[model samples]
Target: MERFTPTRYTLTCVASGREFEDEGWTLDDPECGEPSLVRARYAERQLNVRDDAYGIYRFCDWLPIRRTLRGSHAPVTYKSRKLAEYLGLENLYITFSGYFPEVGARMTTCSFKETEAYNVCARRAEGEERVLVVASAGNTARAFAKVCSDNRIPLLLSVPEDNIGALWFEEPLDPCVKLIAPCCGGDYFDAIHLSNLALSSPRCYAEGGAKNVARRDGMGTTVLSAATAIGEIPDYYFQAVGSGTGAIAAWEANLRLIEDGRFGNKLMRLMVSQNAPFTPMYDAWRAGSREMLPYDADQARADAEAIDAKVLSNRKPPYSLHGGLYDALVATDGDVLVATNEEAREARRLFEELEGVDIYSAAGVALATLIRAVREGRVERDKIVMLNVTGGGEERFRRERGNRVWNLRPHRVFPLDADKEQVVRAVEELFA
Candidate 1:
């Protein structure tokens, strides 16, 4: 594991809309477009603290539990030239933290969840009987599995069975982490429901996801890393999002850097992309609305569920909060893109051909969004730009004997109305 550090600090409320403290850090509060001024300087690592307690998110260095990239999982090299040409920006850079090995960007979980999982558990209470419970569609589960295995920490992960085997790599099962695959045909929403129940168990503590400052700050490391590699923050930031967590993370990280007196506090124009059928935020943004309709939620979520990377889609996003995602987009003049699967596939191919690496579907969507931004002239070509590729490069992973699945289907399927005792007995049998 890499040594993580903190450069500055601040606090915000998920339930409320207020800045609690800066503690020596600068702030770039974005609601749409670029921040007018920056309190901090540029090109340095910083930590963004949303909540005062729980987890700390360092912007630059991201350590993933006990996993190493020496033999099996090499490293991904960071390259910014190709991305610069695509966005037509002078100092544009691409943050490679997935499967690409040229720059040693080996993120074991493949997904960005590695940012959250390793950071959270690494600083947790040591030797405590901790039962960490999480809800995921796929990527987060894989990240948790890798973390638990590497760190030897006990974890309870719940996910839809359909998404279970689809996770990119099959890591060896760690006895401490139990993978609960939903019995009934379901999606991420169902997984969240089951995760809620698992967290309620006496022995476990739910990873307060959205409210967990560590997860968001951890995910923000990509931005810090990107800016660090490029020597400054970009004018435009782009990515594929489900819950908009990564975008939120990037916004928060830049805000912290602005306060630290090291980075310019310009709120990069965020461009978040999603699969067309499941693009609730994209649809809502296109319809000229800040809030999402319930009907839109159902359609977007279902559409996201219809895809191979269903885990990337989050129904309830951080946009609901003031100065949140919706607030950031509106403030920074951000844009959203919804691409059809066909478009995503084409985008992926184009990117692979030009960049010379296969990308995951989520990355494809993000690339598509970047394309839209470039064509519309939404991005300022002369300024700096950064694109976050969430995941990719499966064909490169075939070298390792990496295919395994611990089939821990829920002990028993339960109805929504299933009595507590019945649920208790079914779970108790695992202990028995």
Candidate 2:
């Protein structure tokens, strides 16, 4: 077995600015009563891109983990010519996190969520052997499943049965990965509910949603890669939000870049988008309120079902939490845009036609917002822009890899409203 040393870093309370050693795997400051994010303060203040490492690990100086899972897998950033011209933009750049072989984007899961899954597992792998538990609408569960399976790390994924079709993979599923689906009619939130119940077991640990620093920092690499590829910080950053984790990650990454003294000083104007009818963050932000009001469960579920991007339907997002999406948006002077299902569909078609690669529906929402921003003069044509196509290449991936059911059937399926005792029994049986 190859033992790896932990990275040199400290955990700093985002609210108090107090620092502590990387004592263990932690999500929150136990000492602080208020909710706050704990950021990793790396020893290296200056970033020198390591050309020797593969993919996102090249920035391992900033990543929480010291070990490298070198595959040609990482987000690829490039200047857009045809798409830029079509959109009538001068300096449009796209950071694609998918299986676009032409540009060397080899995210086998075809989602930026892979970045979060990889780092979260790697960080925990350095510590004890707790089974990771995660809940998602679709993309995230698949990403976690793929990365955990590839690394031979144990993980339990809970997803709504409606979204289980999205969990297919190109390669055969590893036995280490266990998946549970809620057969009872449930959305993403119900999956989360079941996952929370499942976490009651001592052997299982929550993946800490957006509160996990490793997940945030891992996704932040998209911004870092784009800044390095563009040779400067972009004036505008665009991405579609579910829990707004990626946008928060982008903001955090830009902050580090600004501190590095090489990238431009100004923060990129964050232009995050959400699918319409189910836009909690957008409504809250537009109301100029940090707090998000809860939506009626039935209404939210119906709206989420109607949307083209079901993955962007997080009900209880980490918006108002300290050092979260609200703070990130305020720091960047960001604005949230809403994209209707029709708009997102059109945008997806346009992007695929012009960019020569199929994009995820959430990416279409982001692209639609970019178009809206351009029309509203929120973003100037000449300003440097980084559009994060968070996920894509599903059609291409399926075409090339064929429809081989990796794990032909899920490990188990349970009701969304299953009791704690039932969940615990299922977990015990699976692990036993």
Candidate 3:
């Protein structure tokens, strides 16, 4: 008889077609000399949701982590009654990842980014000395801060100063997690640059945004949860993406579920959306170009500033990378859509009124796109559809626990154009 084995997933380079073991945080195979997203190939070929495991760890068979973290919860997937009826759909399921406790969502950060933070941070070596560095628009920062703080993992976060308001937490973070921001009016890209510059310090390591298999596979758990609840793959999957990492994760999960042979072997059409005025992916997809069209930096910043959902303002996404969002969309016959602020606000209101929970603006953007798809006849009424509510319950969470929730204050702020030496020195001071 064969022995049971867990945590036996290998990393596969999409570009080089080579498989290798995971060495902590290897985002790409440098030997291949090509930039590509590496995928996790699990040893377990069959779908096995561990009954003993809690939260995201239930899908531990497919995740690329050796251990699970505390306070981690999986996305709550349920067939919608009100939202589905209101949309006049026979099969609409909602995979919600947020703080709607009534429906079993306990993501304290009120975002699915917790999925990334828990898996990514857990992937670190047991005795790693290097400080994990993360760059975020807002939600990612809060998610990482919360997980790293709870587990006492040394972490440094960089976020745009304007979006710092999103760093609210259930309680004050521990000292192990520190935050910094770009002072001179920057966007998510600027936050990435600041964190990248901080990487000059030997003590710092990059979180590897869209390149990290841990992050993608963690986010992929949403689809895993949905598939488990639905008993099969859906006809369409919808999400709002800034970097399109979540959508790519869904695609990867779809492939894995198909391979498992228990779930229906069908590719769900990924209906991803971006907030209007900052819709780079939508523009590129509509133009039928694999290469993203050039949007001037100044104009992108202007557009980013104009959007209500600030998290969806990523100027550069993973669409053009090998085995990235572009490849995933093409393989799934997906389409990118856009939603205006007015449309998104209305969508949020509609969803909250019908579904009995408030959702984030990014989630609103996703629902808005679905609304457009249905009205335009892009999606059939009888088709099975899964809507990924990436974040929500902030209004409820705040209303219930506002007095106890604390803000994660910045440890330091640097000029947007600060050189590497200056940034590294400031970071060194934090650990000193």
Q: Highest TM-score among the candidates is held by which one?
A: 3
Give the better candidate number (2 or 3) by TM-score.
3
Candidate 1 vs 2: which has more TM-score:
2
Error in Å for residue 229 of model 3: 0.3
Best by lDDT: 3
- Steric clashes per prediction: 29, 0, 0
**Candidate 1: Cα lDDT at 263:** 65
Ranking by lDDT: 3, 2, 1
Candidate 3: 10-residue stretch with minimal lDDT: 1-10
What's the lDDT for all of these models? 0.63, 0.86, 0.90
lDDT of 3 at 72: 84
Tens digit per residue, CA lDDT, model 3, 145-173? 99999999999999998899999988778
Tell me the deviation in Å of residue 412 in model 1.
5.5
- Which pairs of residues clash in candidate 2, taking residues 3 or more apart in a chain or in different chains? none
